[model samples]
Target: MNIAVLIKSVVATDESVTVSGGEIEDTEAKRVINPYDEYGLEEALRWKESFGGTVTVIGAGADRAAEALRTALAMGADEALLIRVDERSVDEHATAKLIASAISQRRFEVAWAGHMSVDNGAGQVAIRVAELLGWPHAGAVVACELTDDGKLLVTRDAEGDSEDWELTLPAMLTAQQGLNEPRYPALAGIMKAKRKPLTELTPELLGVDLAGEEASPRTERLGCETPPARPAGRKLAGTAKEQAAELLGLLRGEAQALKGRG
Candidate 1:
């Protein structure tokens, strides 16, 4: 089983987000492997351990993104490939194109990625890559097994429910949160990862045309603003009857306001 896992480097969730000139100033932000992508990496590692094959971690981003690939390496992936792209030119479609092009250069039995990237929250890249590769794809997979016949049986999250699917080899799957607990990089593994092969590539190297007018992003960002600050909670005072009355009053007020707007 030659497995490929997709990973992303993202701004740390706890770090403060600073926006400058319609873009997030993330250059100085603490970076880490995207939380959801970690599950995909772990699943790939598990599959490799069971079937005995090399697991290659693939990523597309600026130079700093290599650190995330290294982290995946430390977590047990055999190798890492980074597709360097201009930060401004990287949208979901462009990213998928670059990743698909890079993967096309190698032989892989299966591919895995997070259901969505935390930074952009655009859950379309992995499936789009599958489309570009003309391979079947399953999203939000929580469990996967290789059958005796070499087909992959996967259980995936379907909103509040679950769905099971059987796909042939060479398919792609996006991992959900319940897939598996991600393993931390051990000290020895961390040291070993430094010695592991980490290759970097560009769109030119991959024979991808990123310069044409058709390469422009289909979607445009108009602007970005921080969410409004949450209002302070109001504490009710007095007996249950008084609180109930207060709640009803508040509801009535909201209803009247909505009616006025209508």
Candidate 2:
């Protein structure tokens, strides 16, 4: 069971976010392992413990992203691979391409990643990487098991429901919330992680063509603005009938305002 887990470094949620030129200015923002990706790492570590194999953590980002990989290593991953993308901004497509290329060079039975990164919340990279590798993908997986006949039994969230699936090896799975509680790195593990093997690769080394017009992002952000402040809640201070009538009146007023805008 040679498992590979994808981890991402994300801006801490408690920090205030500031956008500049349609991008978040996060140069000095406190960074941590994406909360969702932590589930993926935890699941992979559990699999390794059960089946007895190596777990490699893979990531694609700038240099600072190595810290997240280090954290994963501290959490019991055997090795870490950092696909260093020189560009400041990387879309989901490019990220998938880079990671898929790196995974292609290694022998892996399964690839795991978060359903979405907290920073961007696109939730597309794992599926896209599966497409690039021509493998089956199960997203939002909350439970996973390896069967004797070499099949993956996974339970995943389908909208508000749960679905069970059986997939073959070399497949991809995206971890959702409620999968498992992520374990914190112990002091001994943290110390060992400093000496773990961490490899860095470039797009050229992976034979990925990141240049040319075709490689450009399919979508571009025109601009970004903060959402309007939320209005205060209003208490209905009347009987049921009166409250219903007041709600209807408010709805009608909102409808008329929309009509006027149109």
Name the top TM-score candidate: 1
> How far out, in Å, is residue 146 in model 2?
0.4
Candidates in order, TM-scores: namely 0.90, 0.89
User: Over 4 Å off in model 2, which ranges?
Assistant: 231-250, 254-262
Candidate 1 residue-wise lDDT, 1-262, digit = tens: 8999989999899999877677777788899998889999898888888889999999987777899999999999999999988766767778888899989999999999999988889899899899999999999999999999999999999999999999998999999998999999999999999999999999889877776554446677787777778888889999999998887777669545334442
> Per-residue lDDT of 104-218 in model 2, one digit per residue for the tens?
9999999999999987798988998999999999999999888999999999999999999999988999999999999999999999999999999998899877774544455
Predictions in order: lDDT: 0.88, 0.88
What are the runs in model 1 whose C-alpha is more than 4 Å off?
233-257, 260-262
Model 1 residue 119 CA deviation in Å? 1.5
